[model samples]
Target chain A: MGRWEPNARERLELAALELFRERGYDGTTVAEIAERAGLTKRSFFRHFADKRELLFSGQEQLTRLIAEAIAAAPTSATPLEAITAALTALDSIFDDERRVLARERQAIIAANVELRERELLKGTVLTTAMAAALRERGDPEPVANLAAEFGGLALHLAFTRWIEPKAGEAYAKLAHQAVDELRATAAELG
Target chain B: MGRWEPNARERLELAALELFRERGYDGTTVAEIAERAGLTKRSFFRHFADKRELLFSGQEQLTRLIAEAIAAAPTSATPLEAITAALTALDSIFDDERRVLARERQAIIAANVELRERELLKGTVLTTAMAAALRERGDPEPVANLAAEFGGLALHLAFTRWIEPKAGEAYAKLAHQAVDELRATAAELG
Candidate 1:
């Protein structure tokens, strides 16, 4: 719990998201984010490569979470099952408090084409990593690739649905529902 | 036949690909591409919104093609079936010469992350268009989305294999192989 306390990186991320939402991604500056977080610009640079990285550093964490989950799924699990498990595992990281920040991040991304591209790239990177993890779990080539990509799509759908103003439903529930819909879609296609 | 015989737009696209490959995407300018194509800078702007648009102008045609194919597919066709039909129909547009150009474009994009993001965005836009078209054709929400997103994944896999240096293989054949693998993966998941 002590380790969970706000550090320089955490403060920078929160401050950057707030500033990006208020002033727009392009309209804001690294100095502003650092100053808002009560940190130095040098600390901000040490925490992130650039402004884009500020918005996208979570992608690194996402890849780590999904790849780790896929690697940990039972060897007997099918590729799709592994992907589902991996995605479901990610839902815990986005608690109710984080959901608000996630929604604002989505809104900021939606308003900026550059940010949207970064978002898509992040998804692509995660899918690619998940596929590799599945392969390490003994899944074959194209099968692992397809399953990981479909999982990415399922996550995208869940994120879209989860961000809407709703009751106290957890993102994990929404994500699981989206995965079920994906399975149904596959069944229909089959 | 005359209009098809290398208009300014065509010349610019060809010239731009060459220059991009030689000098890198960021190293080249509209003026350089226009001069190389023996056209004025105004002519380049008339055809594309920006330098990035020159590389992605084909996305407009792709959206139109896939959407029209979905609309024109048999009413009884399943969502996946319609997407397959649409993608296969796209193959005829890529002749041997265009395949070479496509390979060059892929190489250029692979070397540049900025261009890679745009490429992903183009795929996303196409998938979204395909989903909307499926909806217009009476498919359900997540089904259309999942099917369309899967179709995009299939397209990605096929393009990856198709662009490989093979012995005079057609892009359509590679695409079919990828789609078959996608179907198998989907069935396995089901």
Candidate 2:
């Protein structure tokens, strides 16, 4: 148990997701997840604070990716353009292999109220981060906040479509389409 | 305890807020709230599922009000126009007296992660309700959802301003200004 294990974090995540799907999220325990992963509970705790953290461990990385992308956008880019760059940056993470895990994770979250709330909080945090990055690039308050919110909405729609069983479009493409649709929708608002 | 209590709900809410403000949310008990309200714990339970409900009991009513307002908008109204009507309808709930309570409530929620998560969930629920009402009025999916999100952002901005100590404008006015500001920001998003 004291010895280091290879791929311990990834193993715990897959095992936890499998257990959560087979048994309800509420019915699974850390000990069971560790057992399924063939790791010590100590190793499991080393990777995640709890079962929920296993599901959201990528949030911090995703937030940083988005913020950095927005920051790296050309200085002349509009708020929405900066947000589009941020969305495009996420394409690597949502590659085909991850789509399967994403679908499972969405189902697990949809079935639990606590997880849904946490997801909303995480969405809010990311949106705020995007806005902060935009502001740092010299966008005003209203533009930064509104663009961040629009970006959040586009990401949500893109993710929803990306997880559909019959969906074939790339994440970046879906995200671009979502943003264009939002732009059209915004233009038509009376 | 078995007899009916006049304004029992309101009394309980006030008592709960006071206790929460004085002792902090986690330190206050339903029994203490009930006692402070000059009522029994049974009366408290009869009005609210728990102490958290005391803070969010208005969510259902607010959701219904916004949805109904959107439904009642003129047939020729655009999605954003209908959303505007819904925001104006909330003016009744944000009168000057309620502003004081809202300020305290916001502080309480800001200080606690659990409460903040619940608040975000409630906000999402209200936004969903607004979008559904817009859909029922024949706005397509994208328009309905985007308009509802805008309406939510406006409501958030309006509420934040309305709770400020120096805020002098009516809630409806603040709400209208927020929507207009969002529209301007959207137009310039490029």
Candidate 3:
């Protein structure tokens, strides 16, 4: 059943994720993923340079979109509103169709030491981009940097809650609540 | 040289850092470190499991102190205040005598991917402990978790600023400012 599929990237991603889950990330091979997707190893290479690239395929595009979204947010938007808008856009990006894959991706990342470091580096990249966006909006450097960092942290915490197996809160709702609580906490500081 | 040394750990740490900076982390060996410190490799291992352990030795102690400080904050303390107080205690722990080692340790961690991952894991452990402390303060579980994560992120950012080579800002002052801005950004959400 080697029928041609136009969405080879998507097919390879699904196959890789399945294989990674069943066999564990280190145990999965490029050839195995290609075979599962009804494609050759060459085709898999076309889609992803390596196994790690398969896991982070959309990272660059997603980071860019989020940065631009935050930058294009209304000037009248409060820092929290601006950050919230950006985070909500991220939620929209992680729709039901992507949630399962995202969860698997998150799990793989959490379980691996090297992947976790890359994840932190990615988070730093996004935070830096967001801070730059804020700075372009006339916010001071340190404030913009700190706001993006703290806001990103709030969003990350909320995402953790949203992804929890038994968590009752909705993603957007919990994110908003988290931002509020974070603000309140910051207010109480000297 | 070893005969006059009262603090073997301190002596070994300094020797290691100096060698690491001069020859790079991979270039420096335990034998060289021990030799430079006028001790044996056996003496070095007695104090540390390996070179990496020297980089993280203070991290464990600092995290423990922060955890305890957060847990013991006044019942009436607000979230940020409690976190700030914990960090202030941390700053005191990183007093003048410790600052040089602290900077060197950070530099070493920065230069290595594996060390950075270990450092991130260490920070994650501290974040978890801090969250447990906040939960014990009788706050709602989700809020407590979010607060702990936010505090960790803020502290990380503040530490980033403090470590900048040409940064003129004092660690305590920069940290206070960063926390203040975090509160303002949070208030903007309202």
What are the chain A TM-scores of the candidates, in order?
A: 0.93, 0.97, 0.89
**DockQ for each of the predicted structures, in order?**
0.52, 0.73, 0.21
Fnat per predicted structure, each in turn: 0.56, 0.74, 0.20
Per-residue lDDT of B64 in model 3: 81
* Winning candidate number (lDDT): 2
Which residue pairs in model 3 clash with each other?
A183-B186
lDDT of 1 at A10: 81
Chain B TM-score, all predictions listed: 0.92, 0.97, 0.88
Error of 3 at B45 (Å): 4.9
Candidate 3, superposed: residue stretches over 4 Å from native:
A1-6, A40-53, A109-121, A157-190, B1-8, B39-53, B107-124, B153-190
Candidate 1, A122-145: lDDT as tens digits = 888988898899888788877787
Candidate ranking under DockQ, highest first, comes to: 2, 1, 3
| Tens digits of per-residue lDDT for model 2, A1-190 | 2456878888888999999989989999999999999998988888889999889998998999999999999998989999999999999899999999999999999999889888988888888899899999999988888888889899999999999999999999999999998988887778
lDDT of 3 by residue, B77-116 (tens): 8777787777766776655555566677888888898898
Clashes of each: 0, 0, 1
- Candidate 2 vs. true structure, TM-score: 0.96
DockQ score, prediction 1: 0.52
